[model samples]
Target chain A: MYSVEELVWNDSFINWVRYNKNSDFWESLRASDPAVEENIRKAALIVKAAAATPEIPVEESEAAEVWNRIRRDTAEPETGNRKWHWAVASVAAAFLVFLGIYNYGKTDTRVSYENLISEVASSDYKEIRNDGPDPVSVSLPDRSSVVLYQGSKIGYSLSGYNREKREVYFSGEGFFEVSKNPQKPFFVYSNELITKVLGTSFTIKAPENSEKIEVIVKSGKVEVITRKDPRKKKVLESKELEEGNYLVENQKIDLERATMKLSPIVKRELTELNHAVQQMKFDFDEEPVTRIIADLELAYNVRISYDKVKWQGTKLTAHLSDEPLYDKIEMICKAIEAEYEVRPDKIVIK
Target chain B: MTRLWRSFIAGDEDAFSEIYEAFFKILYRYGYHFAADHSLVKDAIQELFTDLWRLRSNLSDTTSVKFYLFRSLRRRLHTLAGGEDVYQALPLSENDLRGLQTDSREQYLIDKETEEIHLKQLGEGINKLTTRQREALRLKYYEGFTLSEAASIMNMNEQSVRNLIQRAIISLRSLLS
Candidate 1:
């Protein structure tokens, strides 16, 4: 008969206790050695108890928050020295030039906006056409909102909108407020330029007849890359774009159709024409806490719950434009001497 | 999981997120065990994933993603904790004992009144173990990793890990009696 410690240390016994595996073998052993049955039971209990060690619970919101930080950190272009891949790429490019076979591998994979739309026309893509005189709002399946300008159109696969990735094809001008989802990147394919973001508000102007497609970043980081180049087609290249081609808050990138070149412009003055999402003022001067909370809820598309009666007369005065949504909440909570808990679906202020 | 890792290495954003979702909690729990600091553990995990993403091209496929992440997070937490000895024995807090009791009661589906006293004693006995002993038991029995896998994670020989666990169980039995 095996000792309790021997049974406890056995891998098969542990597996059986934890997952109910190898039951036949365990049952035969128990039947053959009835004297070891008690030892077996005790060992199983020990394994179960050991596995039941209390774990630090990680809330869904907490995981998402950390993920957002990771996404943001990784999305930023690696500062200083070119990454190894770029070094290899440059060396290979130079070698190709030396071999005089560069032009032989140059294949033009560019497609027009009309062709792109027609290709998706047969699919079950939900197409939103703004025939109205003014810009109309379009809400996507992933809670991302798009303000489609007159004579503009946006289409996305209804089935795959938020499942794998949030992808949308657009023509003409539109202001996009994409919801934060680091796992599923938000992709806006407009003309020759594709603007990718984890979660950010931006404006894409890609008129069907315009020579230049523009991406204006109102807030958060935005990556604009040429849609035609297969080498740079992978969304992972957002890291590479951070080095040279990515757009940050208040910056803009204009993609020339003729040359397929990206020119990033640092716009100091964000006019009303380009900065659509930034119109919502985050700077508050003695604003009622209720109003400020409502604005935050509207801006971030998150619900903030608290005792209305307790905070009826609370007011906030702070410049929150430069801070992230969570930081802004933290600052507000600090001013009010309150603690905020991030739940799965909502933020609770106590 | 291997498919997801391969896709992540191939620059698939969705796969990267999938891997993160799959491993975040377990990594968090393991990191917490190493160091109780909430933000510190969170930062270690965050940096671990960030580095993984940054060096994804250099990473090879692993059959056991959990073991790989656990090793990475352990190394990271060790460094972030300023090279403090993670094997050093730590006094179990009252909260930990209470948490153990509740967890065991819920997991075993046993008669609560009858098992409470015994489970409490078991928890105390388990808690009295050295951090190394607890970690070895945790990796072997709780996580269900193979002996060699646990030894590798603990940076010790398999026989040494086996001895540590045997000693831990003997001590627990003595304490229980």
Candidate 2:
């Protein structure tokens, strides 16, 4: 018979119990010394409870942003000594200027061919995951952009077919802001469905272990088509989607309601306008809290507050990065000689 | 080994990211438990990973990459703490200072001291054994190597690995109790 302390600290016995789970020694030990074994089990329970609880330490997204900046800074220009093995001068630069001239009055309906070309990756594509509440930018050669959400993978052929029509595949979920180019449409193949859109913003997801492909548009229209389906014969009978707004491939089309908001014209207009605004850029030169808060409100069109109204006068003047909506608030508060607590929907200025 | 070595050495960013991602959490946990500073751990892990990437050409002779990483981390921790004093004393906050007058900070200090004592106890318990015995325990438990793998890694016989593990556990039990 062992004392409670003796049995609890028995490493071999504990290891045996930890690994085997239903070992006979535990039963025998419990029978011989109930109190000791009970303590051992209680201690195990404490360790197990601590292990089970997820303790995520919160750090500012500054680390991630810094890492990104480092990676970008290290690319090509910064590392002039190291010649880029796969680097090619992107035509997206020229395309941007062309679009600027072409879209003087009209909304640019053409997603830049340059943006489409940018998607032509040279490296072997593999699974990508972004496990944080921030947007991850992947530049396609055509200057089209993809923002992968928290847990998503975007796979594409980088070697054998890299220069071709930019064939890329995706699974899980992601948002795409395609550079407008009417000549070459951007294609995202997932599961059995293919989403083809020319110069538009949209999201597509084909979750693991699920058969359905979910396509949702935030800006421009997308045509979803079935690549391989038993119902292909039926689909071939008619041009299933004569610009019928939104669609689900291989699935029955509810021909009744096809909604179209923000026509191609309006979308072009908005993109041009947004692009110009993005160029103008916003800077706060180490301004006071009150001033920064006012600037942020004007920029993002959101209201901000401090723990005390008097705290507003506290000053902060730092060049703000293109941070997420909430992080900006946090930074503003931090600058102003105060801390801000985050609420579910808003920030509590403290 | 040569194939993976070549892939990594060729500046394959994906390969680097994959290896880094797999060991990142474990390294982070070990670093956090030892250094008690998050930023320091992050920096150490980054340095470790970059070194690993640079030294990929030598991977063929090195078996048990996980063991190598742990040993390196331990050495780094030892250097960071400096000399023999293991525990780091963190600064007290304004709230804690105020609580000291009310005896609350004293209570917290007591609890923290107790936790530090247990952590030291655990470390010392493992340290009591011979190098072989300690290696066996570390490989089997922390690194999750099988008995045969541990034997292979330690370049010892299988029975020797088992015997060493058993002896190490018994010694730790005595020390811990």
Candidate 3:
């Protein structure tokens, strides 16, 4: 006959009692001997009693607050090299002047494009100036691509790029095709406007001399928030061009530089804005369904959820272009004899 | 879990956050069981993570992330407590004993009243064990650590850990009978 301690210390017995694993083996052992069955029952009791420890609750905010402290403690110092320190100081001075012009509405100061370029000209920043007559294509550290129009410039911090966030300061017209990384959001700062995206293609026109800025959404979603003081890093007001809205695609948002007012202007005949859309290729030849869904997810900045194992080895062969995003999804689902549901935050395909 | 650790060592911030999220609560419970100090446990856990990130480059890959974290947290709490006597056995709190009686398997084995009486006796019996015995029982039964892993965590040999758990169960069984 087995003893209680022997049964309690057995790994397979503990697994059976605690996790219901390998019940058949334990059952056969129990039926073989009556004393062993009694020992098994007692051992199971001991395991369950010992495993029933009290739990301590942790708040969600507590985790976030601790992470914030860790992030702050581990952040690199802003001033390191002495030579670059002087350059950063000059850029800070010029930035202060630009902020002064913005806050005071000093048209007499007349901040020129040259002043804007100098303001962002820190040694830590990777500045791209398109001096050629044609638009120059530039690649970001995260593999996102930007088409900088002639006589315009864009700059981003070299240290924090693609690490903490993908941020860039722009004073130009540019078409952006941002790679999808939901963890590190992409932000574009032009004058008072801050455009945030996860992944999408769009166009922004914010010239240093113009009193108005325009943001056109060719694909995906974009959030535009105003910042009164860039030093404070506080958002004043926000607007989002969400997907599924009537004005989602080829929609234009005009921001008055003087008042910082945002108004949406719907114009269906903005045929020139369709260049990026036409450039996207949606032809698939026996591509895996997961890959197709992933591509669509990146292009639209939307989350698509489906049973990966259930759809494993499922392939599609279709040309899904020219139609809207929903229609394209419907066509694929119909071809596969599946159904889809659009949730507020994600799309579910079954 | 090993994949998460590899990515974390490779400086993936998302993977680091995932590791923290996965292990924070259990680590908190383990530390609190010994010290019973809320802020002290919190500080120990925070320091554990901070040190892990700073020393990640020196860390080798490990398949048992839980064992590594638990051992590190225990060592950290030991230093923070300033003495080894902080591990003295304390009686299970009233709520903890109540938790024992509510175990579904115990209910399946016996009636509610008998279960309560037996669990009370078991709780008292468990409290009577040495601190090392109690730690061994917890690591082996509750945390599901294997004998060698528990031995390493407690700085004991495997045979001694097994003997500790054996004596603990024998004493508790006598109390129940």
For each candidate in turn, the TM-score is 0.49, 0.33, 0.52
Arrange candidates by lDDT, descending: 1, 3, 2
Which clashing pairs does model 3 show? none
Candidate 3, after superposition: displacement of residue A275 in Å?
25
Chain A TM-score values, per prediction: 0.50, 0.35, 0.44
Q: Write the per-residue lDDT of candidate 3 for residues A248-290, one digit (tens) a residue.
A: 4555566666666666655323343422222445677999987
As for DockQ, the candidate ahead, 2 or 3, is 3
- In model 1, where do residues sit more than 4 Å from their true spots? A31-33, A76-350, B87-115, B175-177
Ten contiguous residues with the weakest lDDT in model 3 chain A: A89-98
**Candidate 2 residue-wise lDDT, A129-199, digit = tens:** 66644435454556565555545557555563224344456655555656556555556755445566555
- Model 1, span A1-350: residue lDDT tens: 57887888787887777777897998678767656765775665566556655646788777887886787678755354422212211100000000011122222544556666665645777888977554555667766667667677899876767777778888866767666677888777776677777776665666665665666665577776787656555663333335555666555656666667767566624342432223565677898898788766654445577656588897879876534456667889999999998655357788
CAPRI rating of model 1: incorrect
**Interface RMSD, in order shown:** 5.6, 11.0, 3.3
lDDT values, one for every candidate: 0.67, 0.46, 0.67
| Weakest 10 consecutive residues of candidate 2 chain A by summed lDDT | A92-101
Higher-ranked by TM-score: 1 or 2? 1
